[model samples]
Target: MNEPLCPAYSVLRLLSGKWKPAILYHLREGSLRFGDLRRSLPGVSQKMLTAQLRELEADGVVVRSVMACVPPRVDYALSSLGLALLPLLQQMDDFVQENREFFPSEEG
Candidate 1:
C-alpha cells in the first residue's frame, strides 16, 4: 500500500474487530436505531454492540446522534469515510457467501 499501509491502518486496527465490520455493514444500508441494529445482528450482546459503536465513533468512522424526545432516540450511521468502505465490504461478503460451507458452525 503506502510503503507500509497508511496512517488510517491504525484506525482500521480498532475498527477491524469482529462486530465492528458487521456493524459497519448494517449501517451501510442506512441509519439504524440502536434497537434495530441489536436485533439485526444475530448473536451480539447489548454490551458488545455498545462497545463496538463507541470505538467506531472514536475512530471517526461512524456518527452517533442523540435525539431529544419523550422517549429519547439515538441512531447510528456511517460517516463519509465509512461509506467509502462499503464497496470493499460488499465484495468480502460476496466472497464469504461463495465459500460459506467451508466455515462450519461450532454447534455442529
Candidate 2:
C-alpha cells in the first residue's frame, strides 16, 4: 500500500480516544485544577484522567503545572499547539449543533 499518512494520521492517533477530546474541550476554557477537570467529566476515573493528561502532555498539547505549596496545587492548561485547535474545535461544535438532529441521543 502507499506509505501511510504521517502527521495527519499521527494527530488523529493522538486525539483519538473516548476522553481526550473531552479533556481538550474543557481545557479550552483555561487552566483548571485536577479536581475541577474531574468534576467536569463526571464519568472519568482518576486513573484514566491522569493517564490521558500524561498522554496529552507527552504529545505536546497539554501543560501541567505544579505549585510547591502545602497542598501542592496542580493545574492543566493547553499548550500553544493545543490552543491552535480551539477554532477547529469550535467549528466542529458548531457543526454538531447545527446538525444535532442527525445524531442519535442517548436518552432515545
Predicted structure with the largest TM-score when compared to the true one: 2
Top lDDT prediction, candidate number:
2
Cα distance off (Å), candidate 2, residue 68:
0.7
**TM-scores, all models, native as reference:** 0.78, 0.87
Model 2 residue 77 distance off true place after TM-score fit, in angstroms: 0.5
Q: How high is the CA lDDT of each candidate model? A: 0.86, 0.90
Residue 75 in model 1: lDDT? 96
**Model 2, range 15-107, lDDT digits (tens) per residue?**
877899999999998999999999999899999999999999999999999999999999999999899877877888899889998876767
Q: What ranges in model 2 sit over 4 Å off?
A: 1-3
Query: Clashes in model 2: which pairs?
Result: none
Prediction 1 TM-score vs. true: 0.78
- Candidate 2 at 17: error in angstroms? 1.2
